[model samples]
Target: MAAEAKQTCYEGSSVQSFRFFLEHSGEHQAILQRVHDILPGEFKRIGAGKSSLDFLGVGSGGGELDVQMLTLLQSIFPAVPITADTVEGSSQLTDNFKALVAKTTNLQKIPFCWHIMKCEDYEKQVKAKGDMKKFDFIHMIQMIYYVDNLSTTIKFYHSLLKNNGRLMIINEAANGGWDILWKTYKKELCVDAITEYRSSGEILACLKSQGLKYEEHVIPNTFDITECFNPSSQTGQRLLNFMTATDNFYQSFTPEIRAGILDLLRNKCSTEKDGRVLFNSNLSCILVYA
Candidate 1:
């Protein structure tokens, strides 16, 4: 669900997917159109139809990305049964995910299963009952924040795959301006310093350590002011919550300090430009072996 108006327990997990879907899907779809540029040999490896794909997502908050993935998969492998496992701690928007499943069209008729366990735990699960080379494809999106050990997590994802299986990861570019924004969020807006891990290199390194090769995608996205910061938008409301909530944030900040920061941000992120508010988002993604 779009929990922009509330203090989402899922944080950036699901909102990123939904926001991108709503705001940038048109342009972003172009990137999807050029998927070959990103996956190259891996896309060819997914091969023909109905191949089993075990979709693994860590920090899958509200699952909008699952919807997108389902669409992508259906286009290439019609009627293929996909087993989706999402590791999310807790989210105020859980109900939104249930709704997403019901409305999904991409893999609507295909068999789909969702497991709400931790990604780190999948290592043990694979070792316990299943063979390492079972799934055909695996993916991890912007949910790396919840991951405890990147190397360990990647190794496990690799272990779960068949020889042809591949892994994919998408996240904000670590060197982008958003890095500073995230830093500020941690330094100025919370009840405590957020211990949540959010590093892109660490994830890539983990995959490399597992002897998995990957391709990277660098694209631009936006967060419109009307949608993200407008007076009535859900995201706008969430921003208001940030304006008001001090003790629950990661910065160990007092409420007053957060309010001051938001005041400046609101002024900078204007909402009168397009019919919607807009801000540039530089997005980077990588797809590796499963």
Candidate 2:
């Protein structure tokens, strides 16, 4: 399991997996549609009688999701201006987001600020600023694994909310095929890492323990991994690296281990129907209140 000690897998493999998921896989689109269905009505209720909106996005990635969500918010209160503060850990992604913002004329109309740091770092900076504003809506999408303490991080974000403000979180659904694979891969790698795979169930449990009330939405999603069945295939290799959170997992791990992982993915995690291999890649969205 130990290819090299103190080395990280999240930087390369995980990021590439996300890129693949967003581009090739159908799940991102499905999830976005679901968000559109669920969020707009809720935002309408929240924005009732309000003059303007304040938004904070944690782990906003390349701002593609941010733009989609903020668009929905804009549609709700077309006349009101929205001020968004976003925190993203990757400088490359932040730059990409900035570039996207530069090209989009509509995005230019919304006031947006970027913090090229982790959520925790942004929290410290928020404190140091001495004049911090509460947000009407905070969204953390599929990036809680990087937080030092999940409960603490959620609490901190929740604390930064205005009265009746809401915090939205999205993650893999518990007991889903993707969740099972993440658990299996983490056990196989045996790495003591901060970016541990966490599902919505675990996160909601933490919220429940903290006595928070929230609404839950399930978004159905799927990914085609037919290429992954062939070990020599580039797509297969990259999928394996992403699944196991390691680079060159096929070369680094023993043949038996590789077979075990592949068998799990091919047989248990994916369903073959109509000559296509579809992987169950469902995700969940939890809306917590302050």
Highest TM-score: give the candidate number. 2
lDDT of 1 at 241: 42
Q: Where in model 1 is the C-alpha error above 4 Å?
A: 1-42, 48-54, 79-98, 104-109, 130-133, 184-194, 208-211, 225-237, 240-280
lDDT per residue (tens digit) for residues 1-290 in model 2: 10112232224445556576466566568778888888887898778888888999898877888888887888779899889898887776777788988887777888888888878888888889877788999998877766778988988899998877889998888877767776787766646443466788889899999999999999888878888888678887776665565667778689998888778887888889888788888888899987
Clashing pairs in 2: none
TM accuracy, model 2: 0.91
Candidate 2: list runs displaced more than 4 Å: 1-17, 190-195
Error of 1 at 276 (Å): 11
lDDT of each: 0.53, 0.78
Best by lDDT: 2
